[model samples]
Target: MSGLLGNHFITQIGILVNDIEKTSKAYSEFFGVPQPEAFLTDTLDKAQTEYNGEPSVARAKLAFFDMGSLQLELIEPDEHPSTWRNYLNEHGEGPHHIAFVIEGMKEKIELLDRKGFSLQQKGEYEGGRYAYIDTFKDLKVLVELLENDKK
Candidate 1:
């Protein structure tokens, strides 16, 4: 559990929020999740969703933290009718999405894309390159690809 290679089928849940500190504090107070000592950089890109039979890049933001074995990610975007921001603005922000960690990210992205999962955003963080896909219908949820789990 200490090492990334173990993987151990971790379930990563996320909440999208417009304010980082506010959401972090909220989760910490409510769920007893540990607070991060420092902020990490998350470089994001414009993403598109094909759940509606068309594709377009909506607004998005991402942040990360660890909760024991589960990885908690926070995403918030300015809405032009987007999933993250829209959910936060509408539902009031708690457990927005979840991710399953798997190996071979490049092939997974290609395979998921070929299977109709649309790419929303792609970026590189300290851990690895990640691609968020809009699996809006297939999983009835947004799927975030967590890669380079080994540090």
Candidate 2:
């Protein structure tokens, strides 16, 4: 079911937690994955540049743990309205979504639309584009597409 969707690389998995440092430490100490590189909301000038040429304007604590070619971005928002916080506040956390690596995002979105999938939201990240879809909602899950791998 994943082959035609392009290479389903597990580029990232978001684990929305109430505490980032504690979670990072647990992963680093137990699984040997490097504790996430902390990013502050104030230092997202570059992120701002990539996201919208002005940033998404956020304040949160984040860390990344590397596992093979994939990374897990652990986020803890200091405020409300963020999807991560909303997820925990509403649904509790587990595996938020599996990000697939794709090239032509808009086209893929169109394709999904033709396939009867609905878009939840779409955004630009530090190195790629991402969109959340409702295909798996019946199964209580989300399918995410991320454009990365430019080097």
Best by lDDT: 2
Q: What's the lDDT for candidate 1? A: 0.63
Where does candidate 2 stray beyond 4 Å? Answer: 1-4, 41-60
TM-score for each model: 0.64, 0.72
Q: Local error of candidate 2 at 60, Å?
A: 4.4
The residue-level lDDT of candidate 1 at 78 comes to 57
Off by over 4 Å in 1: 1-8, 37-65, 78-92, 149-151
lDDT of candidates 1 onward, in order: 0.63, 0.66
Q: What local lDDT does model 2 show for residue 1?
A: 42
Cα displacement (angstroms), candidate 2, residue 34, comes to 3.3
**Local accuracy of candidate 2 as per-residue lDDT tens digits, 1-151:** 4554677556777677777778778888899666766775443454432221223454567787777788787777665344455556877756666667788888888888788776665655666666766666563666778777488
Residue 62 displacement in candidate 2 (angstroms)? 2.8
The residue-level lDDT of candidate 2 at 121 comes to: 54
Clash totals in order: 2, 2
